[model samples]
Target: MKIPHKAHVALVDGERFLFLRNDGQIFDPKLSKVEEPDLEATNFSAGVKHQDQGGQISGSTDLNELAHAAAAAEWLNAKALANAFDELVVVADPKTLGEMRRHYHKELEKRLVGEVDKALTHEPLEKIGEVLANA
Candidate 1:
């Protein structure tokens, strides 16, 4: 459960994300913030609706789904800045994690170290390390 020094860690949700770099102190690792993307209010619809063949109604896409996609895209951009990391850890809710997995570039996939499928985006920074370690 020991994270390597300078490993990249990302805590993410459907609407927000935080990137950090571990300082290598396993017992008391310091996570220096690298990037924190601003999240905007999700718009559910653009005033358009359509009926399916089954007479079901829906918008072009669910706003929540769109938000998750956006978050994943933002994460990809941030990861690209680092080009590649020694190791990469991702912590996110199950749904968001799936979204990220779907969008991961081949290079990023090779760099992935671990993934914690839980929503720890709102947890305290100190607690986050514990969760990741336990996972």
Candidate 2:
């Protein structure tokens, strides 16, 4: 995950998000913090319950968290449609990544540089850069 210079990096989870830009070189990347987007909750999965992979009943998932992830995905979709960023790298928890992937626009898919399936939303900028550098 050597992020290209100027690539937009989106670190997101159900409850939080941190946007960043790679201001340094590809190998020695410097992730500069970017402002949070003006996003509105889509609430698409507000009350949804996920079935277990085994098709068996399990404890219910957090409805609010699901909705939040959906909202983040919605925002990304809008940005993609508007061609907001030329290169995009998504770093999210596995569940959140799945939600975002479900809503990816074709244009966004084209711009996507990479995806890291881990929750880095609250990680420090240096840690994030290190993880991406080693990924």
Candidate 3:
């Protein structure tokens, strides 16, 4: 597969796994596009610490959380788009759609944070705008 020179970040938040493709055109995560996979649960048992908090958790656990959040966000997006696509079955699912949106976003939030962290891990403390400039 031809991986683009573009940078990408993959991570699991609550109940979802997210893949962010960086186009280097926007600041921070402004124009980043995210793809999420349907995950099982939040069970980080891999001993990842919570940022100098003295607690450790597993990667699995963290992934679960990300999945859930991502699913919630998907639900919300579906709802907002529901009215636009009256012909689609998903558009008719108002309640389920809402739940999915919230879940999708909840899960994605963690993943987004992780993605950003990884991208900046080796950086020399620069604003997201600097990265976008490379585009």
Question: Of the candidates shown, which would achieve the greatest TM-score relative to the real structure?
Answer: 2
Error of 3 at 12 (Å): 4.0
Clashing pairs in 2: none
- Candidate maximizing lDDT: 2
Residue by residue across 1-135, what tens digits does model 3's lDDT show?
111334444432333344445454334433243554554434333223322333224332333343354454454335334432111111112222333334443333323222122223233223332443332
* Candidate 2: Cα lDDT at 38: 53
List TM-score per model, in order: 0.71, 0.86, 0.26
CA lDDT of each candidate?
0.67, 0.80, 0.34
Tens-digit lDDT track for model 1 on 10-102?
888766788888875754556778888665534333111322433234343344654654555455556665785667878787766766676
Q: Output the TM-score of candidate 2.
A: 0.86
Per-prediction backbone clash count: 0, 0, 41
Report how far residue 90 has shifted in candidate 3, in Å: 31
Show where candidate 2 strays beyond 4 Å.
Answer: 46-60
**Model 1 regions more than 4 Å off:** 26-28, 39-62, 81-84
TM-score order of candidates, best first? 2, 1, 3
In candidate 2, what residue range of length 10 has the lowest lDDT sum?
51-60
Show pairs that collide, candidate 1.
none
TM-score: model 1 vs. ground truth:
0.71
